[model samples]
Target: MYVLIFSDAGGAAALLVVRGCHTALTAVVSNRSNGAGGNFFCEYDATHQMSNSKGELVSIRALVEFCSTTNCNSRQSTSANVFNDCNDQTTDYLLGNEVLNCYECTAQQGKNCNEKDRKCSSKKYCTKQIVHLDGGFQLSKSCSNINVLGIDNACANYDVVTNPGGVAVHNKYSQCYCRNKQLCNSGSSLGVVFTVSMLLLVHVMSTVVA
Candidate 1:
């Protein structure tokens, strides 16, 4: 089974295998128990399911068995069968589609830059490529009214370079304004003058011909 394990709170990692991706999916069995709500451990057996969505963050909960390795023996399992006690109460987090970075790869795990935390605080993700700080970049200090995505509290796509030796990830952007439709229509008045000039030119040519 293809299982992915990540470090959570208390420095515990588990390999959970799932069928689908980027969606909310679950599998329940009769011989299993569930734990408290709003917390996630690790699940490695048939009774364990990991739900990861690229659009929203789903809270994981189980009455029992957060981390389990399949039992080749017929022994009944206890709550302490996994671990004597839990170390971290809340240490791990999963991003469904927030676009904040730290993806499912080594590059995301070991990012390129972290010094410009203040600037990239809400702008770019941890997985996104960093740009070297130099000219040709619109600094975060100059941004106003940034846009927000479906899950983002602020708009996505603003970036700044802290290092001079950074690589490009996606199309780098700073900030841009979006004007209202009414304000833009006011500029349509300019087109009327051009139309009137063309009609006058046509009239002058006709009179001369007559």
Candidate 2:
């Protein structure tokens, strides 16, 4: 069985416990704007029947059709099970198909200088990378697909090098991936302590490898 929770702009809330494989479900909603708020209870059984709070078996399809013609505004509805409550998971499900906006810029443009907002698919994450090169550091903030980076949803440090005219040049970088909020890559630091710890870990690993 699943619980369906619904709420509207006028402070009306509803909870429905449904069972069986019925094509239509009846919901007895009260008009809160007219100061007529009262209790509304609805349940469905395995016999493909629905009953209202008055213990009257009403036609599910007819009730739904009646609601549609009315001026009631039910804003949100969520389907929840026992294992999970109605919170972030429900919001995520509602926004699953929405696009994400992220700040897009590079270090060359200056710090915290976002030229435009990058529109990314819901599956992509906003990324921030700090590269420590020979001269100085380079920062890049943009939206990235996790599959293309071959990385998980966390921060990581890595090293890369190039050989030019028999000379070797190496660069170390820290990249962080986030999707919890919009424009998250615009921050100057992920966290001072966290950044320091990651740098120290990279140093220790490099020493061990050397």
Instruction: Please give the distance, in angstroms, between residue 137's alpha carbon in candidate 1 and its true position after superposition.
Output: 19
lDDT (0 to 1) per candidate:
0.21, 0.36
Model 2, 78-129: lDDT tens per residue? 4343212212212231123655555655553245545464433343456676
Predicted candidate 1 versus true structure: per-residue lDDT over 62-169, tens digit per residue: 212232234311212232443332222222222333322222211122343232232211112121111122232212121111111111122223332222234432
Candidate number of the best TM-score? 2
The backbone clash count of each candidate, in order, is 16, 0
- Give the residue spans of candidate 2 off by over 4 A: 1-98, 109-112, 115-123, 147-153, 188-210
The alpha-carbon lDDT assigned to residue 207 of candidate 1 equals 16
Cα RMSD to the true fold for all candidates: 26.5, 23.0
